[model samples]
Target: MKYWLGLDCGGTFIKAGLYDLQGNELGIARRNLAIIAPQPGWAERDMPALWQTAAAVIREVLELFGIKATAVQGVGISAQGKGLFLLDRQGQPLGNAMLSSDQRALALVQAWQKAGIPQALYEQTRQTLWTGHPVSLLRWVKQHQPERYRQIGSVLMAHDYLRYCLTGELACEETNISESNLYQMARGRYEPALAQLLGIGEIVAALPPIVGSAEVAGRVNSSAAAATGLLAGTPVVGGLFDVVSTALCAGLQDETRLNAVMGTWSVTSGISQTIETGFDHPFVYGRHAEAGQYIVHEASPTSAANLEWFCQQWGMHDYRQLNQWVAALPKAGSQLLFAPFLYGSNAGLGLCASFYGMQAFHQREHLVQAIFEGVVFCHMTHLKRMLQRFPHTRALRVTGGPAKSAPWMQMLADVSGLPLELPQVEETGCLGAAMAAMVGTGAFPDFTAAQQALAPRLESVQPDAQAQAAYQHKYQRYQALIGALQTLQSGHSKEAL
Candidate 1:
């Protein structure tokens, strides 16, 4: 049977999935990729190693399923957004791949804020200045690693780099690069003035041509065929930003339901036909895989990773037990709150992850409950903003590691007062990448057709009225506490008033 291959390059893992035209999962495989941190606030990966990991996972999935490379008709990819991957003048890995979690550009972001660059460009770019954004990272490199900066030949994101390795092509998929702050959203092209305004005009030459997500990028080349065990002439499509992949896999075809992803970054995304900005906070917009659509989202590095942090520290993995404990607790009575900003902050920078209102009576289980609630609270912050734009949203399609926990999903539902659907797919990224392939290869006419052909199996969660009422009061306190902290953080309150 003819199948498609999808490579999903996440922050810490690279996964491959094999799918039939009917959207049935034929087989899947994954490999953990190393996250190299030579210094605090610096996250890098070996680019060549990343490519090998992609190849290895693809080969393993094909071999494990007893499928031939020639049987795979099309290939697509989705990966973490905004990481810096570069090829030198020699068409080799520049130095090390910088990850989206990397904060080497934190100070540069602060400087930009002081200089009003974000405000100047917000109407055009629609992305907030962040440490991990390619715009910030490029400036940081020019100042700190000038040697490496000078050798830049091509700049791309993780999936874009992997696509290059497989197809020997240089291009930026629209969904990823649209958020890079290099591209002008309304103009539909990269404006050199943006690079010049950001003081990185010299590196604009490194940016590649833009490619649409479901368009054929190139054919897998002979060397890649030998390395990945794929047919040399297999068509490969331009890929997606990981968040877009998840949104598509969750079947977010319109603004009726928001897609909430609770991974390393907590994200709430909605699909719209036109650009909508001018929010109390910055809302990012990305080109959607579907033609004439845009994905508007608010995200941060605050999400399920906080639970992972607690798991690592306390040597606990009994999520079933931990979740039971959380369910048993009284949600309204707990005064405890966690910031969930261990990696990055949505509230603002210079704020660290912390717990408030802890008492002597609070136990480890209580702390676990606080961690879960804190992450949900952070997501609510983003969700509330999204709801302002998509006011008719009736439900939330939630995805990620935390969605598996009943307590967590229910908490999100109660807090948002919207029904939530948890997708059963093991890897939405891989599936969405495959959907792109399906559309590119004419298996489906467009993204909407692909969605109808492969709707995800979903489980639902309804909000508890009592819990919603309680959370309403608790949420006020939550906002008050965040405002108090912000007053202490910047001597100015974050109250919406």
Candidate 2:
């Protein structure tokens, strides 16, 4: 049986999987990734360490399945988006990779907003300015670490760097690079004008050549082959952003479908035939892994991580126990509202997580329920925005850590008033990457064929009309709470000034 390898490099873990052409996972391995926070707002990972972890997992998975290196047909990667991975002229990492959650460039983002740089760039890229974007991080390096910035020769995303490490090639994948503010949504390439506006024009030379997700980037070189136990000259396909990969794995084929990811980030996305930049709020517009479609998305760090935080702080390790407690609580009319901004806020970078309307009568169950509801509300915020463009969206395919919970999936369906579909596969990101590899290696004619052959069976969760009504009222309160918080934050900023 011909198999493909898929590597998923996420913020907290590097996962590798071996899959057959029929989408059956033969084996899987994962390694915990460590993040370095040298400063309060900085989040980074040792570049070499990341590659080592990825390589180790790849080797481990192959050994687990007892598959010879030559038996694997191809390899592909799916990784977290918007992180900065810089390489020198000789393809050496300039420094630790800046993660998507890093806020070291927050001040630079604020300065850009104050100077109207974001507004001007949005007109071209249709992407919101964020501290973690390559352009922002590049500019931050230029100003703060001038010498290091000067040494940079290539700027790649997380998966791009991994692919480079494997294939001895340097190229940015489309879905990932399109999320960088450097890529122009309308023009379909890196925009020099946008770089100049962000004051990082000089570093534009560092941008790698762009490749489609299913295209062959390069073959595994001998060094990479020796390290990972993969055949030398095995085709390594251009990979995908985790968002697009997971969406594809969940069977999102066209504009009619939406995908909600409740992982480290609360992400809602749908494919669009044309770019829609008219939204008053920030939404990411990027090229889909499949050509001729745009992945319209809105995301913020407000999801299952909120529950993880609550569980950790309260020393609650058993999720089943937490779910039982949450399920026992009243479904409606809870006075507590948790703004799931523990990492960062959708409203702005300055706002932090908080619980509003907390009363003395609130119990642990109430807080837990509030956390669940807050996460659903956060997904609603993005799904609602995406629905504006995809008015015909009939169903949402949800994938992430939260999808494992039936109660949480029901909450999402109830809150969004849309049927939720969960893929039977656990590692949808890895499966998606494998699909790309299959396509790149000519195992399938195209993505449609691979998807048709490998798409996982899905279980559907329908919204409860009665519960939707209750969430409708509570969602209004959630909006009001957000507005009130924003107003309070604005006032505090003025006071500080």
Candidate 3:
């Protein structure tokens, strides 16, 4: 039987899966990588360390399955988005990889906005101008490190860079290239005008050629085979940003279906037959695997990441214990509401996390519950906007780290007023990549066929009416808290007079 490989490169770890044509799992391996947070609002990863760990997991998965590299049909890769990886003329990494969450580019973004580029930027990129974008960072680099910037010959996203190492080819997939702020979403290519407007026209020269996802860019090289224990000529197919891969894994190809990937951050995505732009629905839109299709997605920058911060502040050990503690709390525990915007939000400006009705009597569980509730509240806001855009959504599909917990899933269903379907395998990103590779190399006819043949089991979670009703009341309080926070932030700015 033929086999395929799928790998997911995340901020916290890299996961690999080996599967046969039947979609039955043959083997799986994972390697955790270190996240370097040298200063506030900055997240970095050591490129060498990440590549070494990824290579180790690839070898281990192949060895565990006793598969020859030449025997494998193809490989698919899904990776975290918005990371900046610069390479010199010889393809050597220039500096630490800047994560999607890094905010050092804020000054540059401000300057661009002041120059009256925000609306035009949105028109071109379909993404809000923000500090986390590669375009902003590239401009920042030109201003701060002209010497380092001049040595660059290629710049790729996290997975694109790794693909280069494996295939000895330099190219960026459409979904990823869209994040660079240089991409014209409607045109489906990089915009030279935007680059020139941003005063970083030369930076585009370092970018890789854009390619369609599922295209076989090249075959693995001899050195890669030795390090990864695979056949030298194994084909590598195009994959996408980790979020889109996760959406694909959860069966989000249909225009009426939506997906919520609740991990460190949370994202709500759905397929749009055509790009639609309007009030309060600014989103990052990309093309689907098929020609002439688009994927409309909006993200909440602080979801589970907010929960992690609460746990750390309260000295909790892990999410399970913290979740359990929160689950046991009384209804409307502490009456303390959180806005879920600790990391600033992608939704709108002046939104910040706030604590309403806090008291000295409140305990750690109350705080934890509030954190989770805040995230659910944010998702509900997005869900409302999504339904407005796509009024035909029948059900909601969820997949990610937090989706594994029963209480969290229940809370999501209860809070969002939508039934949730959870896949048996939470590692859908890797599986989706594997499926893409399978089809890209003809192991399967297409995605629909692959889903029926190889997709894992799924279980549905329905909302409990009682809990839903109770959360409904708290949901009102949550909305009020958001408005009050916005008012407070606005008042603070005006008070400077």
Candidate 4:
């Protein structure tokens, strides 16, 4: 009757899932996250509101299943990476947390690139400069909000902030911080020189001590216990980045297999035993859920979120009709194209989301199809880059909202010319976090063992030989358009609109 609890805080939803040791999902509950955007190109979440949302869902799941708080073994969390979540000098929330999709630091990133900052540090950080990175946002704060910068007490990402909320202990999980550009990749620890290099030397002390994935971060204190229905002193493990959680749940049994996550961000990742660098385009590396391993990836804020934006605008919530529209269209003959960069871009800085080559004959369905393909195309851009680094890559383990669609999954497989692996994981973020909890609570020796015992059923979507040829041609057009668009992006800013 032992159980593990996982809380997934995502940009779109705050989900809580309860699972047994055998990986059976006992219950799940979710609440849509309300993103606060006071200015254009800004995405934020109120800290207190976020914690309340998480508490509400956690309580709902426990009550809905009638599970005793004492019966739950441990708790783990999985959340979006690289957003600025802070606590001021009094250990109170500073302001609304900046999301990974926020573009307020676009000008700073561009300025740094012109100064060859990213290029100079790429050998050490192994990450390209991005507007949404914590360093970028922190620099923006130090220059623009000097008072708040001086008042800084601690700097943390979304998951770290949540872990602190649960346990009242200040810790930085290694996996998420590895991608923050504040940590030295090769040395596998925080280096103050990196902070100085990024122009935020004063905030070095704010970086908390690092903790391993399966280690006990802290226990749920009385405050969190009363807020949520959990018992006091329930152990909480150092959680994971959502992508890391998804990879473990997707059954990435070996290095040959890759994982693609399509959500608020389109992330393509592969695991490596040793760190590899020296790429023309730097691939971001984060500490793996497993000790001594690394997860190398390329990601952008271009994915199914595009559909969410359309849903908000058109006032439609369901996906069946959109899939049907895309399903009706033939794959190869469409002349329309879409750049899925509403939130962020993979091509380069300051790229706007747009539909190109639209004709009078195009209908709403055609536009929907273009959106699907545009998202897939953006994912492919990252996938193609990853394949160069992971040349031995064999299969893709896919997950996320878009993967639920047969038409969309088929498009991804056909475009990549590789077989798509769909694991029977309903909530990857939750299940992945549970895996960490299981390990921390001594349910398994490590993540690999935990996954093997709870391995999910598998479904495969193979590429079509005929469709692959057509997709190769279509992908060429997508690449050409991206090239043209990048050329026209000189001095442009997404926030300018």
TM-score of 3: 0.92
lDDT per residue as tens, model 4, 1-497: 88899999998899999999889999899999989999999999999999998988989999999999999999999999888999997889999899999999988998899899998877787777888889999999999999989999999999899889889999999899888888888888898998999889989999889988888999999999998999999999999989899989988756789999999999998888877657677778888999878888888999999988988898977789888888888886688988999998988887899999999999888888888889988898889999998898888999998889999999998888889999888999999998899999999999989989999998999998888887778778988999989878853444354
Clashing residue pairs found in predicted model 1 = none
**lDDT (CA) per prediction:** 0.89, 0.87, 0.79, 0.89
Q: TM-score for all predictions?
A: 0.96, 0.96, 0.92, 0.97
TM-score of candidate 2 versus the correct structure, residues matched by position: 0.96
Worst ten in a row by lDDT for model 3: 343-352
Which pairs clash in model 4? none
For model 2, how does the per-residue alpha-carbon lDDT over 1-497 read when each residue is reduced to its tens digit? 78999999987789999999888999889999998999987889999999999999999999987999978999999999997999998889998999988888887788888998887877778788888888888989999999998899999889999999999999999999988988888779998988887788887888889999999999999999999999999999998899888878888888788989988899988877787656577667889887788788888878888888788798988888777877676576697898898878787777778898888888888898899988888778778878888889999999998888878888888888889889888897788899899999998988878888987889999999888888888888988888888899889888977
Task: Quantify how close model 1 is to the true structure by its C-alpha RMSD in Å.
Answer: 2.8
CA displacement after TM-score superposition, residue 217 of candidate 4 (Å): 0.8
lDDT of 3 at 190: 80
- Candidate 1, residues 1-497, lDDT tens digits: the string is 99998899987678999999988898889898888999988899999899998999998998898999889999999999997998998789998989998988877898899899999988888787889999898999999999989999999899899999999999999999999999898987898999999999998888899999999999999999989899999999998899999999898988898999998899999999997656576778888999889999989899998988899898999999999999999875688878888888888776678889999999988899888888888898899889999999988999988888998889998888899988787889999999999899999999999998799788999999888888888778777777777777775323321
| Location of the lowest summed lDDT over 10 successive residues in candidate 2 | 275-284
lDDT of 2 at 130: 87
lDDT of 2 at 56: 98
The CA lDDT at 373 in model 3 is 84
Over the full model, what C-alpha lDDT does candidate 2 score relative to the true structure? Answer: 0.87
